[model samples]
Target: MSHDNKTAAYFGARDLPDVIDYVGEFGAELVTFLPFVYWLYRAGQLGDRKVSTYRGMRPLYFFLSDDQLIEKDEPRRFVGYQKRTDPSIWGFIPNPNELIATRNAYEAFPNYRKQFQSTRFSFDKPLLVVHNKFNREWNSDTPVNFFSIDQLEQMFSRLKGYYQIVYLRHGRSGSVDGYSPDHNSLIDFDETSVMQRHPEVIDFEQHHREYGGGVAINQYKNELYAACHHFISVQGGGAHQCALFSGSLLLILHKRGPEAVHAYSNGFYQYATNPAPVCMIAFNDRQLQDGLGAFTDASLCQGRVMLGANGSRIANDLAPSRVQRKGQPVFGTDRTPEPGDVGVHF
Candidate 1:
């Protein structure tokens, strides 16, 4: 969880380690799994980079030669994905047609793979500055994850209020009902969207959208990441960093829990170095009926914020321009971890 660990520092191209920690040196490589089924759709709409690298960190130099570039790269190599770097003792599980989705992701939209060249997108000119009030609720909410909102609430009530529930997010809009605007992804649900009776629930996402205006969702999320009790890395794109930096919990809910199905992600979740409060629960009833015991209970989801911060969710380190133009907060803060909330997940 040491974000500034010099043990894996980049010495330079000439001094690279033969098999150093690739994932640690550059965390964005985890998003390589963008499925092809939604390629052009994501590009045309959100203009989302295929990879999900954090804002300031430079990417690692991919040593892949032309020969190694496309030798069937695993989906987990992408920024949005977490990969299993080692061989799995568990036998393979099938993803059926989903393999086509992974293939299409690489072949159709290849910007993420371009990391061997450019560090990030470059603006030919200064970015166009437009200041206006932006608003949307639950637009960027991710529909899939380790547990349903109902499932999470149930678990929290049973667990003696393990953690509070504040939701972080990215671009969302009217298009995010059952599917995103272009239909590349399902709707990203607001953490409180499904909460009807939980008085302890705090939805900074909803308030931020209505009253806490900002230029972009990431700007708000940066603040949320800063302002939370614990930035639990749950089921979506916007919250990746909390798990990486602050060392919170990880809850991975998958429909197909087969160790082989999406093996790289399961491997990543299974082997993540971050301490406990992390759990991987596959809700595959089919797998369950077959004597598969790979499921965790809904009561194990403990990474939500119980109350909302009184102010903005924008992080302080925002570029000066973003601070001025976006109308977001200068910084966010994280409270000390409570007793049960702190640990490495075994």
Candidate 2:
């Protein structure tokens, strides 16, 4: 049988209807199912179609909701299949077999960056959404592929002047619906210590406490993300969310996963957005530093540089300029630097 037929057979054996794709994880929902549904909706194929997803995920499907396109939005119940177990069963369109051979979602789907742009919220400075995850996955004792407190401190110290950084690390309590810490294994990080050290950086958990009312947390997140054009995230759902915004630059510190393979080889990193956000993936601390430097340089250069996966300059359109002297103090210090004091060279 063909790969598509085999995929159908696999879902059938699990008693899942062929028309209904099941994805329990938020990352897979963004990278696979959501785009597929959007394609179906755009093609006039979702007249009576329905989507089964976790409860709080409705906001991510706001485009469909706005149009009332799908017939039903059922709650997801099946946890039998995970992308790690079988990528083929993760979504209806762009079957893994074909996706591995040709990454066409970048061209095939709607411009989600444009679709999700928000007019509700505005920031005084350029917004930088930083997402970190700490959980026991792959049976490791502590969290894997997560940003350490030191790394975050370095990131905040470097970019705080040019951007309003919002830190996000979901905890056991006060999590929104469909994203309870119970659903995913949770480990504690020293968020309080980090906040104490860097008082200028906004804590998203606290922001949600103050401003997140009535609406689902995912909806609130969507609004906040829509206003931002730059993001720093670790691997998993947060990185996937950042990847969906277009005309943006996302630096992802991913140590391992099937995503790493797809990103380096199959070009799956570019599949989420239409114009395709600049995605730089770092495999280790050294690469993370290099990627962070590229981001810093981009800001200093007035967003003229776009770095690729290996920290190599992939696109540069304008001539380099000397660092601006009149901006906020360099690196959040009280003293402002003289001309050429800040490094603008990549």
Q: Which candidate is the best by lDDT?
A: 2
Q: Write the per-residue lDDT of candidate 2 for residues 54-129, one digit (tens) a residue.
A: 5566666765653343323343322333232354455344443211324543224445555556665666777888
- Residue-level lDDT of model 1, residues 234-303, one tens digit each, is 2233222333322232333233112223322333322222332133222332321211111111222243
**Candidate 1 TM-score, true structure as reference:** 0.34
**Which model scores highest in TM-score?**
2
Candidate 2, poorest ten consecutive residues by summed lDDT: 316-325
Q: Each model's TM-score, in the order given?
A: 0.34, 0.73
lDDT of 2: 0.58
Model 2 earns a TM-score of 0.73
Give the clash count for model 1. Answer: 38
Looking at model 1, residue 170 earns an lDDT score of 28
Model 1: CA > 4 A from native? 1-146, 159-162, 168-183, 187-194, 210-215, 226-242, 257-346
